[model samples]
Target: MTKVNVIGAGLAGCEAAWALARYGIGVRLFEMKPKKFSPAHKYGGFAELVCSNSLKAARLESAAGLLKTEMEMLGSLTVPCAKANSVEAGGALAVDRERFSDSVTEKIRNCELIEVIEQEVTELPEGVTIIATGPLTSGALAEEIRKLCGEGLSFYDAAAPIVTYESLDMEKVFFASRYDRGDADYINCPMDKEEYLAFYRALIGAERVQLKDFETHPFSVYEGCMPIEELASRGEDTMRFGPMKPVGITDKRTGRRPYAVVQLRRENREATLFNLVGFQTNLKFGEQKRVFSMIPGLENAEFMRFGVMHRNTFINSPVLLNADFSMREHPDIYFAGQMTGVEGYMESAASGIIAGTAAARRLLGLEPIQLPKDTMTGALCAYISDPFNDGKFQPMGANMGILPDIGERIKDKKEKYGVYARRAVDSLQRELDRIGCNSNS
Candidate 1:
């Protein structure tokens, strides 16, 4: 049997090693920690989490929760470890950082099929390999990756919040392009002067997530990546002059120009999800929901992803990688974790599980598992690798908006999400059962 080389001992690397080991494949897991650490790392243990401890909501209806559920069904090594080391964080699965890392390290060390190498890999190894080296990939290895995949593109973590198209109040919003020059490609939310002022005030006052030490990497804002709130805070009319400019747009409801307009651009080809144009923000998730909902036609908007601010370096997965996390040109070389453009802790681990298993299946002369698009894990995989997002790819975490619509509308929010979650679980199970992976899982 061929041995798999798993780089980086973070969440994704550990999961990949575990997945490969489960298939009776020996794995050489590498970690630079204890000898060298990325600027974001501190502790000398595997799977060290530098960001928030919370793994998000535990309820199945939520996007994060749905993703975690699918990972567990796929025989995840992180989800169970997370649950065992959890703290009381209300609905979220928060863990003791040190204890969680210790647990992961212990498991990896004890696994007879796995070996840990405590050195930085400056060159890509020959044969099968999975690179889970995270977002803050730096030094010689980053250069090698850059050489392998061309110059990597970066977004500076200034992404805007995305909302479901179904959640928009159609009666209050109109579809139109600026000056009617292009197709009615933008969803226009016209706001009166009073409404605009109120929203502006709320935005400046909304709570923000303070950046962690790792995130505060000389981050500075210019026109391109400025937060909406930062734009608003400049002056009372700054937003109106910038992103909220209502110059060429007319409100169909009033048959006249409005004070200001917020535009929602289609995110995917299906138009199921739309991102706020020029509304990049660093506000906390709850604060974003509260503040952004103030826009006309968005009073009941369901956010699929919140605006986040950080200094992350990720490869353009849509261009270089396949949906299964393998390089298009070189299927044997896989990339996982944040570096592959999947955001959040569990999402990274989920990528590892797929990449690991995909590699394992190939080694065993078996067909790779084709996770259905309806499943959260599958949707995430598809999202990062879809060619439609090639040029404008951004890191996406698990979100219900990325999934296909249920086709039938359910009035209650909880009920709709519940339906989405249930469908995902069912789709995943059917595939696993069909592939006869349930016994090992």
Candidate 2:
């Protein structure tokens, strides 16, 4: 049996391990927790969801949601754990952090094909390996990765908070999707002009957590999701136009469009957990609760996870990695997770799944598989590995825009997404068949 070592038991690492284990590959998994822990991860469990518990939208029209659906099609353990441990806010899958991690860790540990090592890796081992160390990679191995990846390695990533569903005061909040396009999954806190202005003032005044001098980098926001505080600083109405926009939503009580609306969506399947929509921030925990709670329905809100801004590290994938996430300098090693310049939780795991699958096949004298370019998975890979010599490469999350446009463009945004989803599924199925992966199984 071939031996495969996976560095870092994060979302990506665990996913990679799971994928490889399913392929009958023996895996040596490294986890630096319990022995040593990062600033965010407190528990010693595998696949710990340290940031927010909520996976994004469940709709195929939504990119992250589509990615989750794709992961399910590809046989992801994380998605099923999320579904099993879910607490319903509405449609989005949110999990109890403790249960989710525990379940994943248990499953991985019980697998006879996997051997978990409770220490940090000082260097990349010889033979087939996957580096899914995630964004907050430790200094030692990170240096090794930097050596192989060259100047593309970087530090500085931020995240937002997640709220428990039961803690919210739904009496003061209304349930409805934007423009009523979907069901009532979003918990909306309607704001009058005065209330909106007041929230804006407080948000601006909220104290920001300072970063270390070494961690300072230029402020580059991920276009898919921008931090709430950054949005506020852009302009007063930025929030209204961005996350807090009230265009499609009306206050059910008044039957009028709110001046601005703060939306919270279900984080899990059970409808017992909720997360603030577009509320990722760098505010201090106390400040986040203090100011965010001032929203009408959240006066007594209890946050399951507080908004956080931490240093997220990654390499310039386009310059350093092949479409399979192998460093150009070292083909024996592969990269995965946020470290690959693919943002968001699902995107990271999906990358790991593919990388693990590819690595397993390669060790067995099989050619590496590339997802079809028409699929989001393939599109993300192509984007990061674009051959253009120009230095500009943006970290991307799953989005329809990244996928090849269909020949017949549908004017309706939802309909257009449906076509893209169908094409992606079809394209993915062909790749799966070629790789002997059965979606039904």
Candidate 3:
């Protein structure tokens, strides 16, 4: 059996190696964990969940949900592990961070066909390979990657602040998830109109660390993970409608919905630490302490970790790779994950599935699966490789707009998304059946 090399055991790399191994191919899965760690990584485990733990919405009508469905259909490793180790998080698929990574790491290690290499890979290896080193590809490997894919584009991704649950004022903040769909799993910090306005003002004016010290390329902000303060600079009401939107639950004390809300989601299975949902920021340490403390229930909160930003790099995929995520100039080489311009965590994993499966098929002398354009997985693949976006490629997440439209105008947004999901899944199933390579089979 032919052996393949897969670098970085993050979500994407793990999925890629799993795909190849499951398909009866031997794999060398390289991870720089216990030996070395990235700025965002704390655990020496595969598929570490950093930034945030929530895998977005779990409803099929949502883009993230639809994307995960497609990934599972194609035999995803991470999605199933995520569901197994999932924690209560209302409508979203959230997980206990350490447990999730530990599960993935255990699975990868136990796979007989996958040989786990514990050192860093400095250069692109010969033969078939998949590079999923992610947005924070280290300096030496990143330079090696640039030797083929240009200098690439970079931006900053921020992580939300977490506080010890014991430090929160339970009297002021009540537990309830959005829309009350499931059991109350989130800690809600309700704010009146005056409190919201005051906090918004402070957030926008907070001092931030200068980006000049960190960036070598021109500054470009990825909209999906835009720093909370930067998002606030867009408009005062942005955060109100975005992360702080007070649409679902009524305050237990007032018996009426507050003007805005700051939600704290459980960060670990123990429920001792919670992170502010959608509060990723780059404010200076003191500024973060000052401004974020203004939230009604967080006045005396003890900060476990302050929100911090780190530089991220992604290749201009359209200019360098094919739809299957293999380099056009170097067909034997493949790229997956956020570095391939597929933005969210699941999206990155989906790319790995594509790259690994496609590589597996190629080695087995089977034709590559050019997934139907209507599927969320296919749309993301297309978005990253379409030549029309050559010089101006930007990272994209799974969304209905990227998928070819349903072709009928439906005034109801929910109904429209429902139709989109159904169409996509049906199309994807037919394609996978014809290919003879789905997880269920």
Clashes of 1: 0
lDDT string, candidate 1, 102-149, tens digits: 999999999999989999999999889999998877578888888888
Model 1 is weakest, by summed lDDT over 10 consecutive residues, at: 213-222
Tens-digit lDDT track of model 3 for 1-441: 668999999999999999998889999998888899976777888999987899988899988899999889999999999999999999999999999999999999999999999998888888999999998787789889888776655455666887867668888999998788898999999999999899999998889977643452444556776789988999989998899899987998899999999999875434656789889888998998899899978988867567766566888888888899998988899999999988789999999999999999999898789799889999888778887666545566666666665667776767988999999999998987787767864
Q: What is the C-alpha lDDT of each candidate?
A: 0.90, 0.80, 0.85
lDDT winner: 1
Q: Rank the candidates by lDDT, best first.
A: 1, 3, 2
What overall lDDT, based on C-alpha atoms, would model 2 receive against the true structure? 0.80
Cα lDDT for residue 136, candidate 3: 77
Q: List model 2 lDDT by residue over 1-441, tens digit each.
A: 668999999889998998888878999999888899876778879888866898877887766777887788887989888889988868787889899999999999999999999998989888889999887678898898788777888654554566655457768798888778968878899999999899999999999887654344454556655678888988989888888889998898898999999988664334544668778777888999899988988887756566555567778877788898887877888989988878778888899888887787777777667688878888778767775522534355676656665777465768877888888888888888887776444
Q: Model 3: what TM-score?
A: 0.69
Please identify model 3 stretches exceeding 4 Å from their true place: 152-310
Order the candidate numbers by TM-score, best to worst: 1, 3, 2
Better of 1 and 2 by lDDT: 1
- Each prediction's TM-score against the native? 0.95, 0.68, 0.69
Model 1, C-alpha of 17: deviation from truth (Å): 0.7
